[model samples]
Target chain A: MIAFESVGKTYPDGTVAVADFDLEIASHESVVLVGTSGSGKTTLMRMVNRMVDPTQGRVTIDGEDVAATDPVALRRSVGYVMQASGLLPHRTVLDNIATVPVLRGTGKAQAHERAAELMEVVGLEESMASRYPSQLSGGQQQRVGVARALAADPNILLMDEPFGAVDPIVRAELQTELLRLQRELRKTIVFVTHDIDEAFLVGDRVVILKPGGHIAQIGTPEQILAEPADDFVRSFVGADRAERRLHLQQVAGREVVVDASGRAAGVLEQGGTP
Target chain B: MSWVSANLDTIAEQLLAHIAQALPAIVLAFVLALPIAKLANARGWLRGGLTGTAGLLYAIPSLPLFIVLPLMLGTSIRSPVNIVVALTIYGLALMVPSASEALRAVSRETLQAATAQGYAPWARFWRVELPLAGPALVAGLRVVVVSTVSLVTVGGVLGVPSLGMLFIDGFQRNITAEILTGIVLTAALALLLDALVVLGGRLALPWASGRAPRRRTAPRDTGQEAAR
Candidate 1:
């Protein structure tokens, strides 16, 4: 769980990035933050991992004020994925994924063992581990980025538009992979994106950010799609609210019958992801 | 001209003499530059000071550096020690920025990834930073070497009879063949050294292969987004 209390940030040059932003994230929850550029959504996310200290107010993860913790230590205690895939171009794929665990003081052998496990989770081939980020496709590099973030096995993961840099097809695939990973790992995730469909797809709680760092709406994707809180929320969510709803909705009649354990029985062809 | 061109055995002997003289000094230059480059790139206090110092050294003109350093070091005019110290200083002048800028230009995100992944600072430098910085470092080396070849001619003024001596002697004596031979050989050797750096860069940094021809999106991170 993460909490941001009255967080604000203003640069020395008089540019205000965030003003009095407050947010609470529940444990094991996937919260998607949607905003236009400079809405302070990413700044809010960085606060949880302590990458950027808040100029005002406090950010706590699981009730511990991150300011009290070493920013590096705090970061290791949480996960962070970036859009650039920020794969150290110098390191091989395996080494890049293993970076955090090693930094956390895990032995090389153990760190690599964990890295291989994560590479599998993110769908990276073992053979590709020896290659550098430069050698990878955009999608593959992002998977390594995800693996690297999870390397330390942090309780929470902060992803800043993790899939934004890849081609659309790869982006969609990564989005699906992310959802699947979240289901399995269940680490609390703060996903930031500008795309409405992405926020809808992965967020258990979708928080739409207003232009000036205030919350426009915070609710389940269903709630926001069915009833936006105000004009800003509706406009920000875009005019295709009905179509976006289709991606979130499930019709009972069209549902695929599954075993009691919820394993997939077959495709629910009658109803799509909506 | 005859000493270099007449006999295959003699040319080989001259080359061996040249390498014996050049190799240790070149290796020392790389060793010296690594740390200076790193310091210049990473340390805020060192950047300007190192840059300023190096620019001053670079502008000193090689002949003066060789002349001045020998007197400054209290060495005889013809000492190889003076020759090397001058060359090493000149190498650092160029290599410091080469290494630093190479390291600086490495994606900050990649470094964040390294640190986030729990890599200690030193480990990150070795495993991540150095490899990315390799191309630029080699580029710096190329500049150092070609200039060293030219500067060695200045050392000839100090009475060290190498190819540089041949050129300086040729210039004063107005012997076209000898001067031309030295100049031609120096250029040829400089090219050879450059080729070696490129080869070594490719070999040592196989991971640096391929230039992503695609235009990367100028990663648009809003003030909030940029922090992560």
Candidate 2:
């Protein structure tokens, strides 16, 4: 479990990045911190690894204060992913994935074998293992990034806009992949994204932050969509969310429940009314 | 050409001596420049001062440097060490900035990834930064080799054993054939060395080819080609 107790971060320039933030993420839960720019969503995620130290309060993982732990060791124990794949251009995909394991003194043969398995787990072909990150497309590179993060199999995965750099199609595909992986692995994940739809899709609980990293509401996606805490939360979720309330619509002679985007989202069961 | 053929043994000896002097200096300069360039990368003031010092060293005339190196080092004026030291200094002067630029060219994202992946700074420098810097570093080496090759000819003015002796002898004897031969041979040597550097770069950075897995088709378009 990760817990933040009245955590606040103020820059040396006297800018408040995160103010009076408190959150607790249970084990095996995927919690997303959602906000627009300047919301300090990224800052809150980074503070877990001591990449940004909180000035006012403490963050603990499994009840151990993260600030007291060695920074490198703490970072190694948590998996972190970023946008643009953040891959080493000179390294082959396999070597990139093998990096963390090898750093922890795992033998080369074992690390490479683990990397190969992870490539398959992350939906990349074995043939791509020898190719450099530059040789892969944006989507492929992101998958490699995910695989590399999972190579050491840390209990907590910190993802900061992991799919934000890819196209819409690839973004959806990676989200599905993440859902599948989460179901199987059940690792505690802290995800940060500006996309509300993505937060709803991937997060078990969404912590909506206002402009300066102060929580507006904390609830499940269904709860947030059903009952926005305030006007800002309602506006951020958008009016289209109400249309997501399932109602049968006629398309030609067939009836289907259309989603907010006017696409046929699903079909009603036999007894449900339009 | 006739003088060159008749005195082929002497010409060959001078050519070997030229290679002997230039190769070590180029290698030494390359080795030394890496740490200096890495230092320069981390600090702004050090980079500026070091690069400025290199530019000043490079701007000095080779003849003066060659003449004064023995005095500074307490070696005999006739020692080949003078030519070697002078040429090495020139190589370092030319290479330091290139090395800095090459290392700096590595993407910041890649470095951040390495750090997040738990690589210690030194390991990341060797495994990630240096390999990524290969193409630019080799390009720098090509410039250094060609410049050093030509500069070795100038050392002959100080009676250093090099191809430059042919130019002096040709000038003294008024043999245009000897001067022409020396010019041709030096140009050929420079081209050879440049080609070697390019080939070595290819060998070292096979992934830098930027080619996709080959498909058996006439007009297959790779994304990297389009990206360029």
User: Candidate 1's error at A264, in angstroms?
Assistant: 26
Q: Please state the Cα-based DockQ of model 2 relative to the true two-chain complex.
A: 0.35
- What ranges in model 2 sit over 4 Å off? A239-266, A270-274, B212-228
Residues forming the 10-long window of minimal summed lDDT in candidate 1 chain A: A241-250
User: How much is A227 displaced in model 2, in angstroms?
Assistant: 2.1
Residues A131-152, candidate 1, lDDT per residue (tens digit)? 7676667778788899988888
* Chain B structural similarity as TM-score, candidate 1: 0.81
Q: In model 2, what lDDT does residue A58 have?
A: 93
lDDT for model 1, please.
0.77
- DockQ for every model comes to 0.26, 0.35
Model 2 chain B: worst 10 consecutive residues (lDDT sum): B215-224
